[model samples]
Target: MGRYKSFLRQRYRAILGYTGLICLISGLVIISPLLALLAYPEELPLAWGFLVPGAILGLVGLGLWQLLAPKKATSLTLQEGSVIVVLAWLVAILVGTVPFMTIQGLNFTQAMFESTSGWTTTGLSVVDVTKASRLILLYRSIIELFGGAGLAIITLSAIAGPVGSGLTSAEGRSEQLAPNVRRSAKLVLAIYTGYNIVGTIALKLAGMGWFDAVNHAFAALSTGGFSTHPESIGYWDNAVLEIVTIVLMFAGGLNFVTAYLLLKGNFKSVVRNGEIRFQALMVPLCSLVILFGVAIGLYPQLGKAIRVSIFETVTCFSTTGFATVGYTEWSSIGWLMLILMMLVGGGAGSTSGGIKQLRVYILYRSLRWEIRRMLMPTRSVTEPSIWQGERRHFLQDDQIRQIGIFVFLYLILFCIGSAIVAAHGYSLQESLFEYASTMGTVGVSVGVTSADAAPTLLWTQILGMFLGRLEFFTVFVGLVRLLRDTRPILT
Candidate 1:
């Protein structure tokens, strides 16, 4: 027992220290909203909401950092990395909830839901945008921006040390653009920041005010669907704005590695990428289907129908969830199609979420390979591979098996969440669509998610968003490790 206690103390010291550092960073993030006061001095009274929590968190983090700083340099295990990732996110979300509760007067449940949605880059919202202050709206966007890049990546970029590959992998960012994790993290941030600046400027030139442009740029690039207006992109009714947004969304959905390649004029690698190929096929195919089968009848004008189809399809396929139109009036076919798109999601190692395109494409390739294997002679063997970036990676059985398990678990959770929502009297289709949106981190709504939603429903979607954003395995493994480490004390 004594030995086990010593093991826990030694092993967890580094983890706690890292988590403390993340909390300190989160403290800075929480207080960032106070900057909005410079533009709108009327919102100055709401500053305390951010200040109180930020100070408390900063102090707590300082204490933990001092108390738990590792005595010597130690390597972080996968389990330790996962725990730090989960703890960092949870701390951010919890701290993020403060402003919503204090300024918006949202109850704990609603605030947590908003915080989770923001951090997960899941744009589902309970706040009434028409009534919410700009400060609150910017706060949501800021969190989404940071959340999309990930806290772990931010930490890696800030500190110089051997943080470990496990930290990046646990955060669902296994692909690094540079050999050094810190350099890769900085590159990601640089690219991400550059895009946001460009998006904001483009939107501003496209006729949006600076405030709206900045917020939408942040939300769009982060693949977070939060809008300043209730109508979202439809509020502008400007094709140019939508075009700019589409470009931003597409950029957000590309894997950072692929984006880097494109930026470097490596068109050949981008063309050969499996996930890009999948997206290229999916966007047009789904758009055509929606346009012909569903959108045309809904809109009398051909141009309007085509626009809606392409926009919504990209929104779902990219898991960006910035809808130009509401789904309440859409037919069942449209709902199902969007749900499928959400499930298929965007590129791996991107801000967007869902069962990433890489996995689905690999799964499709694996299916073909399995059939070919069965048809071949007993002595025959063939290797299957896919191009990710500049390299062709051979598909391994273990990799396929892990992806299969992940998809199976993802679908099971989707079904379970849908059923839970359906039990509240929504039809199976509505329940399925809503939960699919939740679990995919896609924020499209069919009127099920609102300010008045039941706490149980909100909580269920909260869990879904958390699981979706963290990609399940990390959260599960982290929790398991947490429990195992504390089992002796529990008993």
Candidate 2:
């Protein structure tokens, strides 16, 4: 026990120091939105809402970094990495709340919900954009921008050291665009930024103002559904803009590795990728079903039905959550279809959330492989493989098992969250739809979430968003490790 304590003490300094460095980066991120003041000088009075917390967090981070500075470089364990990732998110969320609270006069619950929603890229906002100032609205997008890229990735890109694979993997990213972790992190940010710039330009060309263009670009490319207008894409009601958003949302939903391959003109690899193939199959089929089965009946015009079906289907499948229309009047079938899409979500290693298409594709292939195994003679041996990026990787039994476990846990949490919402007097379908959107981090709403929502319900969705965005494993393991680490000191 003494030996164990000594070891933990030695490691804790490095862990806390790295965490402090993450906090330092998050402080800079928090302060970045103040630059929006230059674009909207009228909203300059609200600058203190950001500056105060930013300065305090920066100073606190500096102090921790100095005080907890490790004597020498030490490689972080998975547990340490997970704890740091979780702590950074919590600190950023807490600091993010101050702006909403100070500028918008939102209570703590409301402010935290908005902050969590943005950071999680869940886009389930409580803020009324119509009432929100330009600076405040920009700040929300800024959070989504950085949040979607991830704090850990940003930290990795900005620094060099022992922080590497453990940190990246703990943050739910595994694939690196470059061989070096730092280079890969920078590549991700660069790719993400390039997409954002293109998206902004496209939106501006489609007739949006400069501010709206930038904000929507950030939100869309992050797969975050926050909009400058309350009606979302429907506010403009422009097909050109909706098309731009759809392209950006779909781009955002692509795995970073796949995006890199595509950017390098490796079309063959992109085409052969399992997640891409799954998306290609899922999007069109679901869109057609909604169009003919539900949308046509709802709207007599074929064009409107087609537009609504395609846009909403992509949004849900990508977990992007930008709605061209509401679902208050949609049939149960339409809602169910959308709920399923949200549950499946986008490609792994992407900005989007949910079960991830790669896992779903694996499960589907695993079922086929199982049937083949059952049919084959006892002496037969076979290998199953799927193309990911440029390589055809063989699937291991343990990998399949892990994917199954994750899906099972995901469904269990979804059910529990849905039940909590249903207990609040909503219909089962509405509850399921709302909670699916929450758990999947898809921001489409059937009206269950609001600024005036019960704190319990809001808190429930907040937990759902956090869990859904980080996925379950990293968070659960991080919390358990945290308890284990602190127990010695507490006792």
Best lDDT goes to which candidate? Answer: 1
Q: What is the TM-score of candidate 1?
A: 0.97
lDDT of 1 by residue, 146-236 (tens): 9898898887787656556778889899898988888899999999999999999999999899999999999998898889988899998
Q: lDDT (CA) for every model shown?
A: 0.90, 0.89
Question: Taking the candidates one at a time, how many backbone clashes does each contain?
Answer: 0, 0
Model 1 pairs whose backbones collide: none
183-236 in candidate 2: lDDT tens per residue?
Answer: 899999999999999999999999899999999999998998898888899999
